[model samples]
Target chain A: MTPFELIVREHGPTVLRVCRAVLTAHDAKDAWSETFLSALQAYPRLGADANIEAWLVTIAKRKAIDVIRTRARTPVPVGDVPDGASELGIPDDERGEVWALIGALPDKQRKCVAYHYLVGLPHSEVAAIVGGTTDAARRAAADGVAALRRAYATIPGGTA
Target chain B: MTNIEAPNTADLDRLHDRLVHAADEAGLLDLAYRTVDTPIGRLLLAATDRGVVRVAFETEGHDRVLGDLAARVSPRILNTPKRLDTLARELDEYFAGQRLGFDVPIDFALSRGFRRDVLGHLAVIPYGTTESYAQVAVATGNPRAVRAVGTACATNPLPIVIPCHRVVRTDGSLGGYLGGLHVKRTLLDLEAAA
Candidate 1:
């Protein structure tokens, strides 16, 4: 069996992308941690033939929904607004803007794009997590990326 | 884009640190381990909440060691070197001959009964000193358990840190070691040379 550290380093950033594409970068941190921790707990049972990235993405999506539910219930303090995320040393996060754009897409479409485009998983696996047919996952991802192209073009330094 | 750069490299390292801290706080982390390259070979170091639990030689198969630990301890193992940071530093210093003894606490949970007792005796054998297996068995109050002492040395889970390599034959010949004879000789030479 591979060490959990290798799993984290090899796919940490990808999982973070999946988290960011699912939630805001700030909330993504929590989802990312929860994903790996939950993975670590169940790592012994993870089958030898398992597709690790797909398994982690599924957990991340589940964790993202959990984070979303928690955020919906908790009332936020206006003074603690997270607009100035960069000021808190979030680092080189011009991608946060890109993630924010991706986060704007409808839930299913956003996740589809994140898994397929960001993580490079096939539509079949993406569909397995998002609960849809392969065609729908591909279409949702295509539409999501098209929407990103539109939104990104408006950003100050976008490649669109 | 073939090259996706979403989470920056610096943030990932920072994130790994956060994961270790968070996992540790939740008490979900059971074994925090890391591999260190040594003069003899790469060593796999692991720790529990109690103390350093395992020190494995490269020939011992690091992956196999973690599998055994998962079965014996909790299955929650992560490669969090922060837990073994001081041990690794001390080991490096020891190999460099700057440190005489390891200050890290070791957990002898893997071995039990006579083996554990033998290892406890082995710990105090002192650096640069070699004791015959028969001598160690006598020191542990089981002079007739010479064969048992050899078994303990062969199966010692803590190896170098516990100083199992210090045990030799009664005729002053090097006995077998869990890390192979060459590694045993190298460790002995390291201390003797120091």
Candidate 2:
């Protein structure tokens, strides 16, 4: 088996991107840590032909949900802004603007875009994670991108 | 989106640092490693939470060493260098002729049985001095296990730290070193000069 360190180095950035797409930046860091720690614990048993990136994305999905659930249980103070707003702590750069747009997408569309576009997983794999048909995943991702294009065009000096 | 780039390199590095810290705090990081440039060559140093576990030379193939560690120990390894700072500093001192012995804790989990005993005895051999394999075998309480002693030195997991270079053939020839014979000679010459 290849060393786990190689696994972390090879896939860590992609995994972080996926986490950020699914959750807030603060929560994404936690989910990334939990995903790799859990992956490391089970790495020895992973099959030689396993799709490592997809496997890690699957784990990240579960950890993101865990973080979301934990956040749900906590009481938000009155007048507190919800996540994915202009206060996500992302800098006002082109990349940050793009991430904010992706974050504002509907839940299904956000995950579909993340898994298919960001992580390069197939619609079938995306469906397996999000619990939908392959065609539905494809449509969600396509619709999400089209919506982003329309929204991005209205911003002054925005280049899609 | 087509224009979307992966998170910048600096962001990823910060996230990885946080992940390493969290994994260590949660008792999930079983092995941590880093490479150090030395007078001899770049060396790969690895450790478990117990202590320093493996020290490998570039000639030994760092990738191959990591693979062995994954199979024999745990696969939960990362390239987090903080844990090896003390060991690295001491190595720098040793290579600079300012340190005689290493005081870092060692985990001899890789070697066992008679081999482990022989490695333990290797540390007792004083610097700038050489012990024939027969002498080491006798020191380890088995005079006839000279060949076994040679095997131990050949397979010493933590080579320089354990002082396996101090062992030689009874005829005074350098028998063998896990790091090449040239490296063996270099280390011996360094200590002798100091």
Best-matching candidate per lDDT: 2
**How displaced is residue B75 in candidate 1, in Å?**
3.2
Q: Clashing residue pairs, candidate 1?
A: none
- C-alpha-based local distance difference test score of model 1: 0.82
Per residue, candidate 1 scores C-alpha lDDT tens digits across A1-160 of 6667768878898898887766655777888988998898788788989999989988998898898888886411122225665322245654555655665677788778888998999999889889979999999999988888887788687777
Off by over 4 Å in 1: A44-51, A70-101, A148-160, B1-3, B36-42, B59-64, B96-100, B138-148, B180-182
User: Across residues A1-160, which tens digit of lDDT does each residue of candidate 2 receive?
Assistant: 7888898889998898898887777778788888988898788789989999999999999999898888896411112335556433255335666776777788899899989998999999999999979999999999999988987776677766
Model 2 TM: 0.90
lDDT of each residue in B27-56, candidate 1, tens digit only = 878889999998888999999989999999
lDDT of 2 by residue, B1-194 (tens): 68776666777788778778878998888899999999889999999999999999999999999999989998888888999999999999999999999998899999999999999889889989999999999999999998899889988999999999999998999999989999999999999999
lDDT of 2: 0.87
Model 2: DockQ score: 0.59
Model 2: pairs clashing at backbone N, Cα or C within 3 Å = none
Best by DockQ: 2
TM-score of each: 0.80, 0.90
CAPRI category for model 1:
acceptable
